[model samples]
Structure formats: C-alpha cells, structure tokens
Target: MSITLYALDGCPFCVKVHDALEANEIEYETVWTEAMHSDRNEVKRVSGQRGVPVLVDEDRGVTMAESEKILEYIDQTLAQ
Candidate 1:
C-alpha cells in the first residue's frame, strides 16, 4: 500500500487518524504496534519516534506523527 498507518489498539488518537482516513475513503495498510512504547521499534524506525498514529505516505514522500497533524494532513492533502 502507498499509505501505511502505525497505530496502537484502543488509542483514541490513533482512532482519530484512522477515522480521518476512512472518512476520506483512503486505502491504507495498518501496522498495529505493541501497547508498550518500548516495543514500538518499527514505529520509531519509520517515523523517527515511537508514537501511535504515525502516518507514512510513500506516494507523497511523507512520514509524520501526532494525531492532529495527521488529521490536518489528511484534510489538506488526502481528502477528496
């Protein structure tokens, strides 16, 4: 998939990002991370930080973290 979302289960922030993508009808692959922050090595490697709700859009050459920023990005760029 061109877009990949790194998220943790039961995270509200992560849910927000996921909802944005879904609302926009964007297709993305999801990588569910471990509940413990220390186990989120893949998230850190991809996003430079182990934060839930990390978005990686290879097509846009974008990788970012934070729920609000990700939501903004989706609205500004990804939203149709």
Candidate 2:
C-alpha cells in the first residue's frame, strides 16, 4: 500500500497533514496543486475536486478531501 497527497505549498491544511504524516511515520509523496490548469487537471482526475490536502490511500482504495478527514483516516490507518 502506498499513500499520495495532493497539496499546495502555502496551505495551512496541507502543512497540518504533512506534519501528521511525519509524526505518524506515514511515507507519502506530495503532488502539488495547480500552478496552471494542467497541473490542476491531475488533482481533478484523481479526486474530482480542487481541494488541496487530498489524501489518496492506495491500500484502502480511498481518495479523500478535507484536512480533518485526511488526518483522521491517517490516524486510523497508520497511527496505530
């Protein structure tokens, strides 16, 4: 199972999720949100939304938005 995060550099929620991932020892790669329409298309393709800090959990077959939900999912799945 692998985890990927879609986020923006200046987003507070993105930073929160990143911090949680690090603290919980979750190995995840971040894909930045759009600098252009094309960059954003990937996020839309994956999650169907423009929200940053989306978490895609390949192991559980979940793609989610919102920082809190992402954090909660991470805590439940990997924080142990």
Candidate 3:
C-alpha cells in the first residue's frame, strides 16, 4: 500500500496530522505543496480544495481532505 500526504510545511493542521501519523507509527510519503508545484494542483484537483494535509492512499484509491478527519480515518483504517 502506498500512502501519501499532501501538505504545506507551515500548516498547523498538517503538523497535527503528521504528529498523529508519527504517534501511530504510520509510514507514509509526504508531498510538500510549497516545495512541489505540481503537487499543489494535484491536491487541489483531487480534493477540490487547496488546503494542506490531504491524505491519499493509492492502494485503496482513497483521497481525503481535512486533517482531523483524515487522522481519524487513518487511525481506524490502519489500526489492525
């Protein structure tokens, strides 16, 4: 399974999501929107918003917006 997190470095919501992932020991690839121009558009296209902390799971073909919701979903989905 390939897990990707699209986020901007300075976003507090993104930081919270990151912290949640780390606390739960979830392995994921991070795509920084500020650093990667293409990722910004991709995130916007996928989530219909330019906000940070979008989570994408390629294996499951799932993309989610909202940091708090994403964290909860991740925790529930990967908790096994």
Candidate 4:
C-alpha cells in the first residue's frame, strides 16, 4: 500500500495526520508542500486543491483534503 501525505511544515492539521499515521504504525511518504498556495502545484495536481494535510492513498485510489476527513478515512481504512 502506498500512501502519500501532502503537508506543510508547522501546519497543525498536518501534524494531526502525521501523529495519527505514526500512532497507527502506518508507513507513508510525506510530500512537503510549499507555504504559498500558489506554489503547491503537486498538491493541486493530486487533490484539486492546495491544502495542507492532503492524503493520497494510491492503494485505495483515494485522494482527499482536510485533516478531519483524512483522519476518519485513515481510521476506517488503515487503522489496526
């Protein structure tokens, strides 16, 4: 399973997702996004928006934004 998290440094939402992933022992790759929304091309390419804490789960064909929803999805699909 390949999971990629699009995050920005110092973003609390991103920290939440990062913490959850770590607590669950779920291995994932972190794609650090730019601070400026206009510079977040990679995030927009996958998620249609330039929001931090975007999650791309290739194994599930899921690409989503927002921290709460991402956490919920992780719990439902990837939590042990």
Off by over 4 Å in 2: 35-39
What lDDT score belongs to each candidate, Candidate 1 first? 0.94, 0.87, 0.83, 0.94
TM-score of each model, paired residue for residue? 0.96, 0.89, 0.83, 0.98
The runs of at least 3 residues in candidate 4 whose Cα sits more than 4 Å from the true structure, single-residue gaps closed, are: none
- Misplaced by over 4 Å in model 1 are none
Error of 2 at 51 (Å): 1.1
List all candidate RMSDs to the true structure.
0.9, 1.6, 2.7, 0.5
Predicted candidate 1 versus true structure: per-residue lDDT over 11-47, tens digit per residue? 9999999999998899999999999999999999998
Which digits, one per residue and each the tens of the lDDT, describe model 3 over residues 1-80?
68899888888999998988888888899987865555478788877877778998888888998987997887889654
Q: Stretches of candidate 3 above 4 Å error?
A: 35-39
Q: Regarding lDDT, does 1 or 2 come out ahead? A: 1
Q: In model 3, which residue pairs have backbone atoms overlapping below 3 Å?
A: none
In the range 1-80, model 2's lDDT, one tens digit per residue, is 59999998888999999999999887889898875555687889899987787899888899999999988988887785
Candidate 1 clashes between residue pairs 3 or more apart in a chain or in different chains: none
> Number of clashes in every candidate structure?
0, 0, 0, 0
Ranking by TM-score: 4, 1, 2, 3
Q: What TM-score does model 1 achieve against the real structure?
A: 0.96
